[model samples]
Target chain A: MVTRGTTTATAGTTRTAEERARRVAADVPDPELPMLTIDDLGILREVHVDGSGHVDVDITPTYSGCPALEAIRADVLTRLDEHGMPDATVHVVLSPPWTTDRISADGIEKLRRHGIAPPGPAGGAHGDGRAPVPLALTVRCPRCGSPDTRELARFGSTACKALWVCGDCAEPFDHLKAL
Target chain B: MSGDTTSERSGWRSAAEPSVERVRSGARPGDVSGLVEYTLRLGDDALILSQRLGEWITRAPQLEEDVALANIALDLLGQARSLLTYAGEAEGAGRDEDALAYWRDERDFRNVLLVERPNGDFAETMARQLWFTSYQYELYDRLRASADPTLAAVAAKAVKEVAYHRDHAAQWVLRLGDGTDESRRRMQGGLAAVAPYVDELFDPDGVTGGLGAVAVDPAALREPSERHVDGVLDRAGLERPPEPAHVARGGRRGLHTEVMGYLLAEMQHLHRSHEGASW
Candidate 1:
């Protein structure tokens, strides 16, 4: 039996097909929102292998109407196919909607590096200078390490984000909303 | 001992509460016509406005702004789909989202005149967005507590989305109004052209009264909507136009502006031709 939740695959270990497929899929990143991996966004639901060595991946959209879904599907197919999993199917699920709480800690770091702030915690506003915000306070400037940032527009380049301008660095960036 | 155990089981079973079958039923036709009509009206407003916003996809002045407008349009389209689908199911007409969207003629659409207006320029689009989203946000807020559970659910979801839309438009309105002289002039002109249509959004038709308990009275939406609009105007340093005398009417009953037919043709062309095609 494969050890669940183990970060590393042991040397000389015989891994199950499902585990191998998942390890391979770890490389698939979100196409439009490149900062977060599909798994980190909570879009990647499951990865499984069939008797014929085909892979099936389930994904859920953040919102029912996102156009990026089509692009994401195509990207998944391309990535998996190139990884030698030629027969792969990407299934889109609608139940149990995607939420910001699903984003992993590593995903937040990736977003910060990409010039966008990861979503703050579930229901608190950003930087009102209140109690240490539970949902990750301190939106560091993607350009410079400055916490002095203000919202420019609640809607940003995409539906999932809002525009923010760093007062110190004078650069604008996107803040992923805590949906 | 076995006999005693069986007797105890029987006694407990008899004492337990009877199973109640509570089925989730769709909205009834006549009972929810007003509510259905109201939902369709809201859906049409979003659909038409979404189409107008979509035109800016590749044509926006900047690449980022282009993506922004397209994203906003996508959100509106999503809201429209849910609202329209719910409305069709409630109508009990065997209609679905596509049927209602593609099969309906121009006169069948119930959107406000304001949303049907053309997106002339960036200024015009921003003016329209400011007016319409402000109105929609207020409308959704009240509708969240609607008697109909489905309507309430839809409103609760949409309220969060529209809040963002309103904020985005509000920022642009202020920027344009406070910017260069030319920008201010264009903004003023855009606002003037769209202001007359706002009157109809507040006007109540007879359908709202008929669906009394099941509907949000359109008349009731007037005061709060006006207050919201006034707040946006104040922040933008713009004055509200004197309410227009002749309110545009008949959209609820299928009478529509000249542009409706063209819009329908484009929106429905594919579905009408193929009958059933899935992406």
Candidate 2:
């Protein structure tokens, strides 16, 4: 079973085929945002290995009809194939739908480093991935670390991002939307 | 179009992997036909509305609104894909999401008349969205407890989405209604034009009629939908237009307005023109 905060590198158990596969698959960068890996985005739901050594990976999407999921799947396959697992399956899960809260702290750092503002805390503590609360946060500029910024548009180049312009830096950047 | 990700080679099904169903992790619906009919309505509503929303991509009043509306359209398309896939599974018709969306004629569509109504003006579009999103918010909220796991899961995700959409449309309504005299008049006229179609959304039919615990009764959603929409209107200092003398009907029975034919023709044209083509 998969639990929160569990990643391939953190699961320090006896190395199994699944664990090795998980580690390899975890490093596959999100196709849309190459700076972030699947594990970093929190979309890699579960990695399972059957008794016969068949591997299966479950991933969630940032939004429905996110065109990136297919690319991410192919990237996962390519990574797995490179890791010597030629036959693997990728499945998409919708329940406990993907939330910005799932992005790892390290992932958030990576996003900031890559000039993208990370989402604010998961809607608010009581949101529980269900409630409809306004995610009103004062986003800091990823470039100059200035707290002055304004949302240019709610939708960015991709479904998961919102376009924001830094007040101080005057640079337009994408903010991973808090959903 | 050039950098398409998913390959059609994945196909719809594979004999080697029996566990990989279209809607992963969802239990097979109990009453297949009931679920099919019910899901088709949900899917069609989202699908049709998505196509209409897509029309505003570069044509919205503002660039930000263009991006916002496109985002909403993409979200709706995603929801429609999942529901349609589930509908196909329940129907056991071997149809995929694309087939269900592209192949169906206007008369075969089960969407409410509100969504199929053309996007007249900015105010008019917002008015239609206000009503549709409010109703959807209530319907999906109640549907979270559905007997069908697939429907429940879909609703759980959709409930949050429609909330944002509701907020977007509500903001537009408030702005347009309280703005300049000309804007206010336009907003009022938009509400009146869309008022006739509002009644049909809450009218139950064969699909939503008797599904036990699995389906949401359209009639049951009327109060909350009205309350929410009416609250937004009240905030905007606008009154609800009187119900039209002639209520539009027959959407559930696959009877659509003439605009639907033109919409379908445009939506399905490319797919029909080149079968089995991707990207």
Candidate 3:
């Protein structure tokens, strides 16, 4: 049987199921929402290998209806098959739910680099100073180096993003909300 | 032996706590059908609107706006898939997403007429989005507490997405209404065009009435939906059009506008041609 960190017997080194799954998932980028990784989004839930060497991967959807899911599943299967686990099954799970909190810190940084602000902490930050306006706040522009930005819309290209425009650069960017 | 062990453990656990047993026992087959129909209505609304938005993909005035419309459409499609899948399973219909989506005729669809209307222009699209998403957000918020676990789960997830959609439409409504004279005029016209169809969404139907305990009453959703829409229109400096004199219905019973048949034909053509085919 294959282990978590080691490669299979036929391979060079033995790898654990989680490690194998993570390695395979590393290649499956978020299809539509490209800034984040499947791992980063917490969609890559679990990977396991049976005694027969058949691999099973579990994934959850970011949103119930995102069409990119089919493409992601295909990518996962293709990547894993290339990695030597030829018999692989990708299962979709819906329990425990996917939350914005699952987004990794590194993913947030990557999103910022792409010009989209990472979701802010849930229930705005606490400050002793008078309660801040719930709506208006400084959002750094993704395209131009400008803080003079206004929220154009709370919804952006996808449900995951909000629309914001920078007055200085006259560019509109998508802001990824903190789930 | 493993199965026996798991079942024994569950039985012992249930004996120790009667609440779990009560919940299981309370579940009836008819309740499942009710839940299925209720979920189908929600799915139909999302699916139809998503298709309408998809029409704007290449035609949007600006490139960025084009991407924006496609993204919204994707989100709606996602919700539709989940709702339909859940409904299928609950009903024991042996239908999957593809079957529900491509197999159904126009008359079988339960979406509101507003969603299936043609996308006239950017303003018209925004007007529909603003009105529909506002109503959806409110409906899903209340549905979060539905007696059916699956419905509640779908609502809990969709509520967040619809909230963003509502906010997106709200901003555009404000911009167009408060912008130049031309923009304001288009916004007002768009509003007038879509206003007539809003009443049909909240009207009660037989399935909804039968599914009352497990599902949300459409009539109950009307008040909050109206309040939310009115608030947005008021803030946008727009007038609410008078409710239409005669409201159209029958979507739940599969009767739809002429446009629905064309939309369905395009969506289902390939699937019907090659039965059970997959990419």
**Total clashing pairs for each candidate:** 2, 0, 20
Off by over 4 Å in 3: A1-28, A31-36, A48-55, A82-84, A113-116, A123-136, A141-146, A150-174, B1-29, B180-182, B274-279
lDDT of 1 by residue, B176-236 (tens): 8888888888888887778777777777777766755555666676787677667877887
**Between the candidate structures 1 and 3, which one is better when assessed by lDDT?**
3
DockQ of each: 0.11, 0.31, 0.19
Of 1 and 3, the candidate ranking higher by DockQ? 3
Best by lDDT: 2
lDDT leaderboard ranking: 2, 3, 1
Docking class for model 1 is incorrect
lDDT of 3 by residue, B1-279 (tens): 655322222211111112233235545434666666778989999998988888887898777677777877887887887777766665565677678899987767888888988898788888888879877876777776666655665676677667656767887888888889998889889988888778777888777788755666778878877787788788878888766677766676677888888888877898899987876
Top candidate on DockQ is 2
Rank by DockQ, highest first.
2, 3, 1
Candidate 1 structure quality by residue, lDDT tens digits, A118-152 = 87776533112121213335776777878898876
* Model 1 vs. true fold: TM: 0.71
lDDT string for model 2 (B163-253, tens) is 7788789989999988999999999999999999999889986656668788999999899889988998999989899868898988888
